[model samples]
Target: MTDIGYIHHEEHMRSSDLISDIVIGMSDGLTVPFALAAGLSGAVASSSLVVTAGIAEIVAGSIAMGLGGYLAGRTEADHYESERRREIAEVESVPEREKAEVREVFAGMGISPALQTAIADELAKDKVKWVDFMMKYELGLDEPDPNRATKSALTIGLSYVFGGLIPLSPYLLVSHPHEALLYSCIVTLICLFVFGYFKSQVTGQPPVSGAFKVMFIGALAASAAFGVARLFG
Candidate 1:
């Protein structure tokens, strides 16, 4: 007799909060600063000016993105807490109504009425479990981690800084803005394509198309910025 063994390893990567934060930060970081440098390159003669402006923008953008991430995390936690409190209050004041809701949850799950009542009655005896059940099943909420806000802020901010540096690095080494812009365009577009490729693989999208799409967006934004700056300058 031959037996087959099954393994449960997942093939695709799942995105976490960190991944979400990095995407938010890196996407804006790479695109915005690339466009800014392209615009400045068209308008300015000195690479020094472009480098300075890019650094300042990266710093400000990182802070703003970090703050936004922090606020979003805090809001999520607060909303979950608010819902939990309401659930707790209902469990105490109108328990029958709450239990009926539990029955409804089971009914939706194809549980028979008699079995649903028995299960609801059994589940209600433990207030903590009852409240937890409602919070998850009825309200669709999970408790937020205490450090989620801080972690999100740091992750997004750091990612923005890292991404912003890639486009700006050429300016630091070169004296002419136009020359630096050429190098920046080459490197940043490559980075964008690579980033998108990996991101697509993780999220289960078509990698080659995703890479081209990302590269196109960054190129378009930079081209538009450079064109506008050249026209205005």
Candidate 2:
């Protein structure tokens, strides 16, 4: 079929980029700040200290997490570029070897030797297409979006700030640390459960189980921190 005659199906699907950012940012954001607040509440009588410490942690965590995400994105792009260059060199310097490699891929896929040779020959004629094909099928690498690093950094940082606010919001209203913590626990646990449910739905897992699991983890972290702080205090 002609290119114009073919229907593009990609428009129907959604990108998982934003979801990934939210997951990374929110998971750490919720868990870390919640634990810190819980720990502080156990040790301090005033909610203001907890609020101050929580804000500091959220700011630091967001920056660190965002930087890490940005670095990861850059590393992936660099790795892909390096592999692309290597593939191009290999294709130029060792044409037969590259063709054989291409044939091997199709052969493993159950394509006949004749068809493999034909496809390899056609692929070899176009250097860019050949490298792209090798990059995907042979190396299992995709061409990342150019703005992925910046977008991922911003998404993760902002999501962290948003998630971190949930547990800390109670402290802003309540005067006592213990009272704030009680409310924070309720709010954070509910948010974690709901977040996990929707996350599981997106990832094709059981929503009920995921919700419980996430809630348990959040509770566990906060409880552990609170227990330790109380022990020392």
Candidate 3:
């Protein structure tokens, strides 16, 4: 009989940093412009004004959000690099102590004292690997991508623009703001529910509840804005 090899497979759904940026950008993009357009519809008769205002908001919002993402990414990368340099210095100055920390990490995993010492000694032979291993196990930091800042900025900015376009599209076609608002409301509400549902699924929350929550919040914000505009206009 021929020998057979067994393959093991595991599958899991995870939410990534990119997904988080998209959620932040898209959620605000969809809700903010939607609320603005709804409010303008209450105050004005011309769809042209609503479309113009919505476009302006989308441009400003995307830039502001992208800048925020870039700053956050930069801070994260900087923090990690600073910590890594400190770890390297510690490794050089107190080699024995650093080795002890390595053994401690293995010990925490239920490794035998002898095995821990053996593994730590082996790791200490290579300074770079030792420092990197310590960074991961002791400091709990993985190296951030060098281009994380630029990538985050672009992702958030583009996602915002894409989401912002949905509600504003109806206003471009309809001459009357009120008619455009009706179509915008229908389209945006559907999108909010769908977006929230998928967002919750990826993030491991209850999908239906999350969808309803998102939808309710969007409607309430727009309603409040519209009411205010109508009252004052």
Candidate 4:
């Protein structure tokens, strides 16, 4: 493969990590608001209440998701930087020890000592490549772009709000609670299935399985909320 092709392949694989964030946002947006609307429908029996609850859920949840994501991204960046600096220092101060460590890392992976030594020697000849390898293999970390994390958070938060709107739209547009709920359920399930299929594509899993998993979690969350509302209301 060409260099660009390999890079693209790697990027595609890395994109799977964002799926977790997307799923979290989507679940939060759809489940919480739908449950709130459902609960309000049960307690107040008003379409207005359902719509209001959904609006509140979307606004509050979006802000929370965005702020949470930003803070988390910042924290990860700081930690990565700190660890990278430490690795760099070790490489500078203890070249021999670092070389042995690298050799041992390879040896533990079933490579012969001689080959490991040669590989480490060649790798260590380039400081940037050596550091990059150590960070990835030894520390189990990849350098993340700061902008990417921020964008991820924003996308996730928006996705959540978007997903949530699916269940609430019927209530906003229709006056009948039962019909609204039914329509909401249908829309929510379709969205869940689509999201799951996309997630499966990213992770190389079965689309049906992922769809079911998403639906199951959304159902559980909404059900739990409904139960809580019943008990308290």
- lDDT tens digits, residues 68-143, model 3? 9999999999999999999999999999999999989988999999999999899989999999999899989999
lDDT of 1 by residue, 1-233 (tens): 54558557767579888898898899999999999999999999999999999999999999999999999999999999899899999999999999999999999999999999999999999999999999999988888988999999999999999999999999999999999999999999999999999888877799999999989999999999999999999
| Better TM-score candidate (2, 4) | 2
TM-score of 3: 0.93
The lDDT values for all models are: 0.95, 0.94, 0.93, 0.81
Q: List, residue by residue over 1-233, the lDDT tens digit for candidate 2.
A: 46987777753224398898998999888999999999999999999999999999999999999999899889989999999999999999999999999999999999999999999999999999999999999999999988899999999999999999999999999999999999999999999999999888777789899999988999999999999999999
- At residue 98, candidate 4 shows an lDDT of 86
Worst-scoring 10-residue span by lDDT in model 1? 1-10
* Candidate 4 minimal-lDDT segment of 10 residues: 5-14
Q: Best candidate per TM-score, number?
A: 1
Model 4, residue 20: C-alpha shift (Å): 3.7
Q: Which of the numbered candidates is closest to the native, going by highest lDDT?
A: 1
Model 4 quality (TM-score): 0.82
What is every candidate's alpha-carbon RMSD to the true fold?
A: 1.4, 4.2, 2.3, 4.7
TM-scores, in order shown? 0.96, 0.93, 0.93, 0.82
What number of clashing residue pairs does each candidate have, in the order they appear?
A: 0, 0, 0, 0
**Candidate 1 has what TM-score?**
0.96
Candidate 4: Cα lDDT at 140 = 94
For residue 113, give model 3's deviation from the true position in Å.
1.4
lDDT, candidate 4, 1-233, per-residue tens: 45764533344444554777786788688777877776665566678778887888799898899778877888888889999999999999998888988998998899998999999999999988888888988899998777766876787789788878889999988897767877887888788778877777777788889988988877777677667777887
Evaluation by lDDT, superior candidate among 1 and 3: 1
